[model samples]
Target chain A: MSDSTQVAATPAAPAEVPVAVRRAAAKPVSFGQVVGRSPFVPYLFLLPGLALFVVFFAWPAVEAVEASFTDYSIVNPLHVVGFANYTELFHDEVFLAALGHSLIVMVGLLPFSVAIPLWLAILVNRKLRGIQVFRAVYFLPVITSMITVAVAWNYVFADKGVLNWLVATLGLSDAPIHFLLDPHWALASVILVEGWKGIGTYMMIYLAGLQAIPGDLYEAAEIDGAGAWQRFTRVTLPLMRPFMAVALAIEMVNALQVFTSVYVLTQGGPNDHTTTAGYFVWSQAFQHYRFGYASAAGVVVWAILIALALVNHRLTNGKQANTP
Target chain B: MSERQVLRRRRGARWTVRRIGVYLLLAAIAVVFVWPFLFLLATAFKAPTQDVYSFPPSLIPRPPVLTWLHNAWTQIPFPRYLLNSLLYVLGGVPLFVLISAMTAYPLATASFRGSKVMFFAILSTMFVPAELMLIPRFLVANQLGLTNTYAGVILPGVLSAFGVFLLRQAFAAVPAELGEAARLDGCGEWRVFWTVMLPVVRPTLAISAIFGFIFIWNDFLWPLVVLNDDTKYPIALGIAYLTGISGTDTRTLSAGTLLSLVPIVVFFLLLQRQILEGAKGAVKG
Candidate 1:
């Protein structure tokens, strides 16, 4: 609007600002000058997004901290209560059990997420037709909702579901496997679901890493009479380290927050066997009306995650300096 | 030169059995990865006797019928949900792409004052889990009187930090001289951005679009919390309703799951090639 007004008043633009001043400032700026001229433009572009980040991401985290120290209930309303919720969570056995289960699920899922995906990516990365279809087929669950995957899979693993039907027919068992309903299988089931969702994503990451390596490395090795196994062992393994690190780190952090599947499939049910730290927090805040306690749990989860991130950062940094 | 070929021939003969064995193993694993879908697809068409699992499991329905599929189609009005999903995705993704690309350009390319603070501010958001925003987001939506509306569902997701990061990486990787050359060729600032800069990163844009489609399509939590009307829900939520009734009405429920999965499956098949390329780009970028 203002630009149009200025264009309209150009003949009489001296009224806005004198042409004498304009001529003084009208000397052409250098190419180097333009790089520094719009120092504020980038900031201006970033301002709205930065504001959103702080409000939705950063501020809610701060709010979670405050909520943890208060006596908040969905039914009775919230007010200050110094350390009451934290104190309660510390003593709760089920909360402890849920926390343990979360760790167990993380442990069970980490190797599968990193190792299995990398293996599969390597196997399918060969020069072959329909490999693209294989990748797409594998990654379908990843792009789909973890929620739907959990629900559909629940039927597939049900007592009278397809898995059990197959198991019985193979003479593996006389009856259906109690995958979801049983205590022993419940947490493992959740981890398996997470691994399934993640394997495709890891495959893509590994594929990218593999593609980035120069073909000359393999060609040069082949000219030196290196066998396929020798080439893969000496070349692929070393080149793939960075990708493995990234894949491992991401899978670790993500597995900490496995909520959707647990919420939908288990609902913290079958004697609370499938509850992870995330679903535990959800149940506390939303279901049981214990916002204060849930917030404390959230804080604990955050701290643990932060500590692991720090350790990973330090280890990776150390290695980066030591290696090329 | 021929020594390499002799080595290859000897090794190929030696590893023939092993290569075939490996392929067989991979094929078996592929079958396992795909088994659930096959079962679900069959169950969607199975009759009562066919649906029920016994000692001898049936791979295919002895007499397949569309009864369950018909029931599922009518029960949830699956077509309405697809329309709602299309409206939601169409309204949100392009806006997100624009905002993300525009916002990330300066962060990536230009040298500016206080850039670190802005960069820090953006990076910090990546760690905040989506679960953390439940109450405040609800409060914000309610204050705006947008509860259960399209605005509520689409607005928050459109301004993602991940999108900004993705676009920034793309824009930053472009040669700066091309941008300078464009500017010297008599382009305006907006022209330089839209005409000169955007085309260089078409693959990144495609990646963002595919990502936006997936995340928005399958989302259930925000919709479950925000949208009350079943008709406003995306296809996944519609399927959740199937689960809600899957316990009681087995046949109809199986059909509903299949109906819900069809769009995603069709989409995967249609864009399988582009999706693979997009995945590769994701790794590179």
Candidate 2:
């Protein structure tokens, strides 16, 4: 049986054909022909994945939309309350604060997610020995669980933690800042951790963009007597705009949904200062069991995300067109 | 010295200085990335008499001890949680890869009637944020009698847009000739796919598996939502549980957290090259 199978698998017949002729002939014979001409075979292959997608994603999405309009809870009988949740949410101080906090996290993350990562990528783009080791070290936090990150940083943010030690030793502050306890510092502290954990990912994205740039472009800029900064601005920046857009878009989405750090670091406490829109949705549904209200808030957050993505798309495209 | 030779030596000195400056800068930034974990490790092993936080932040333990590690292990079902995490990864990743590959195979190799539509529809799932899906997906799982079960945690996560997207790209890159030759040998589509196409994309398959392993291992939120029983909690969630109970004992918390990180970190160290390369490929696609 093994001998027969081996004999049948030989490709000697196709090898005899001229390369160009074989290439031309191969174009018409799709893999479906090899699959015994069954039109249903493809569907059969796709069935399991499509079924899971529908059950988990599509159905849940539709239910989310429908649940937003109803006063649904774990205990109560569902009743239609069209737009009341939305109206109330706009007026709700906590929800609005959460939205504002999400925005703050987004803005706070910009330097880490964009600027610093770009600089790091450029620095690491060299063809030096031990560079890959440095790259892996930089990316270590991105792979570690957020729970672990939060725990590790707890030591860093303790009353007498390294950060406090630095501040005090540098004479920046006489007293230690309550990094996770004070309302003023709590959200910012969470943002700092979020940004720190995320720099590696953004750096990797920028490194990918950097590696794609041809060496000749830099050589050409050098031949023109362009300095390093001038070459970066003239040749690299324009080419990297698309990557920046990607990094910015990802950072925005991540910031808007900042929950794990908030959960682990502050639990959205100290007067709800760290309460982001993502955390609000989770707390409302799971903590309060207000499924409908949470769904409404979720829909609003989803809308904002989509709108921001669209605005980002337009701005990136507009800038691309404006550049010489 | 000749004028040209002096000029050359001075330029070379400056170049060496600049290279040293770059290395110093890189090492400094790497410290920023690595210091937290190092501090965690130091705190975990520090003797009980030693202060975990101090002026200037001493990172070296006076004498490392295993007391906290033992406490972390014995305090709350640590081994059980680790096993649960292993179970989740083992249960989820294979299905994730297999489903992704099976789904991608047809979309890439055959021109079915709705292949394009199917691809786009699946791809759009990436935009639906997990926060948005939380309530309804939980409800769906509840309806399916899946909540509070391992399947609930594993099933919804097994099908991700990233996996499908990555595998589709991989499958499409396979040459058509291999599949054709197998077919000419009177092999069926399944045989062709199993023997020819799949082997050709083994590197991509390994990449997907590595990503899947990392994702499932580090996942916290969904498992937190799905599992009501503490016994079923994965290591990440278990560490959070440890933090909640161990409150002020930073040493024990650090030890538990460090313990949870070990497997994933070792796995990453072994496969960092593939991971870093795969990350670039993922973005470009």
Candidate 3:
């Protein structure tokens, strides 16, 4: 989310302590000083972590890019195809459908990620009793495994389950609608589950933003005869821009990488109607052993993520500068 | 005085109504979030005669039974799967936390030659989607002969930027003075890190551990990719397997799913105070 960077940069203690003590202590002379002051010590500290990173992230990332250019079936040695996989992907129906599906999910999640969660944050941000308990209750979904959540919702989306019952009772539909089995409803249903599970996360992020806002700003606005809506529009929303930016960026990444829910719930089923880019990669690589093709799709997914991230970065950057 | 008192009384009445409205809204939202789990709980206990799905969908299991729970356990090696999960968490979380702390220590305290580069390098890893890395990572593990093994599942997860980033924040939050004091006492960087720095960030370590536990416990895709043997399947995958076997029987599936969830949920509830605070602090960034 880049939230780590933002949070890490916040200096914990006030800068009352002078730099002299730190500098002096950093260069303390002793037998240990021989080891401590060496330029190699930091590398020593970083060695194990960096080694794991090399083996897992760095090397594999390079290999993934490399494999994307090659026809590397699991049963055969790699053969360089020179963008054949990518070109094939352009015409691949499932790949195109997966791309479209991922976009739909990404777009569909905005309300839950941005708007509803903001409202949720505001509601739970009140000074009512047992508020934390309610916050925890809402966050239960986020903590639980996606498999468990998917299973829980499987019944909820059953033809005669609670959702259909609610729809029928409200006169929203004429009959009980099959949510997961119907191709039109499957992707939307999965997206809803993804959104529902993630609302707690976004809510907490917005809550932090809401709480950071000084109450005196609201009190001052009230004194000036601004009602709740005016205070929210004038004071709260503007101040929460940075938090929303972070949330949006995170949501885009999360929504793009949605796999567990799709795997557990729909398996990109009902004629590939629910195959996301992430799920497509898995299907290609694991299910079919099309390593090169999967790597190519993976590269596409990576490119899309980078593009979205850059766009979000620019948007948030401009807004944040204007605010602070 | 009477006029002012009457106005004050009316304001109090309005506030009460508003408070009641707020509570109702909160309750409604809570129900939306909690109902699925409650339904899961009910279905897991429902007797065979009770309809798991009906026109109105009854949640109360008339004469709940444990037959399904017994079936779920016996049908699959549920205990074995649980043990595999526990093994992954135990083997993975500690190493994950330690590596993260080590990586964070230098970034927080030292202005090394390549510290900035190192920090960005680690942060950049977050951008590499796990979905993309799945194929290549599995290949690397294959080349290393780690496939179909515990190390394959656990090692790759230890290298996450989330842990390093969170610990970096915690380590940086510690005042430089504590580090200085230890250094002045002739402590080496290692001693300073182990005795001086890490202890101060113990709560952050605990937070990292909790996160690591939840992640390794619930992890599905990577483990699914790396491990081929059914015997090595963790509980998350186990639940998926159980569903595959009992496709139509809601009772058995619910019991298995519920069983899979209980451990982590209980663990979370027990340590919820700390976990929630950690969550808030994480997003406060």
Q: Give the DockQ (2 decimals) of all models.
A: 0.33, 0.52, 0.48
- Please state the Cα-based DockQ of model 1 relative to the true two-chain complex: 0.33
lDDT at A306, model 2? 80
CA lDDT of every candidate: 0.73, 0.86, 0.85
User: Tell me, what's the RMSD of every candidate?
Assistant: 5.6, 4.0, 5.7
> Number of clashing pairs, model 1?
0
Better of 1 and 3 by DockQ: 3
Question: Whose TM-score is higher: candidate 2's or candidate 3's?
Answer: 3
* Residue pairs in candidate 3 whose N, alpha carbon or C atoms collide under 3 angstroms: none
Off by over 4 Å in 3: A1-36, A75-77, A322-324, B1-14
Residue A225 of model 1: what lDDT? 97
**lDDT per residue, candidate 3, A1-324, as tens digits?**
111222232222222333454457555322223333455778888999999989998899999999999988879787899989999999999999899999999999999999999999999998998888889888889888898998899778988888998899899999778788798799999999999999998998888888888889999999999998999999999999899998998999988899888988988898889999999998898788888999999989988888887898889888887764
Rank by lDDT, highest first.
2, 3, 1
Candidate 2 displacement at residue B73 in angstroms: 0.4
In model 2, state the lDDT of residue A105. Answer: 93
Write model 2 residue lDDT over A136-243, tens digit each, in one string: 999999999888998888778988998998889889998899999999899999999999999988898889888998999999999999999999999888888888
Better of 1 and 3 by TM-score: 3
How does model 1 fare in lDDT?
0.73
lDDT of 3: 0.85
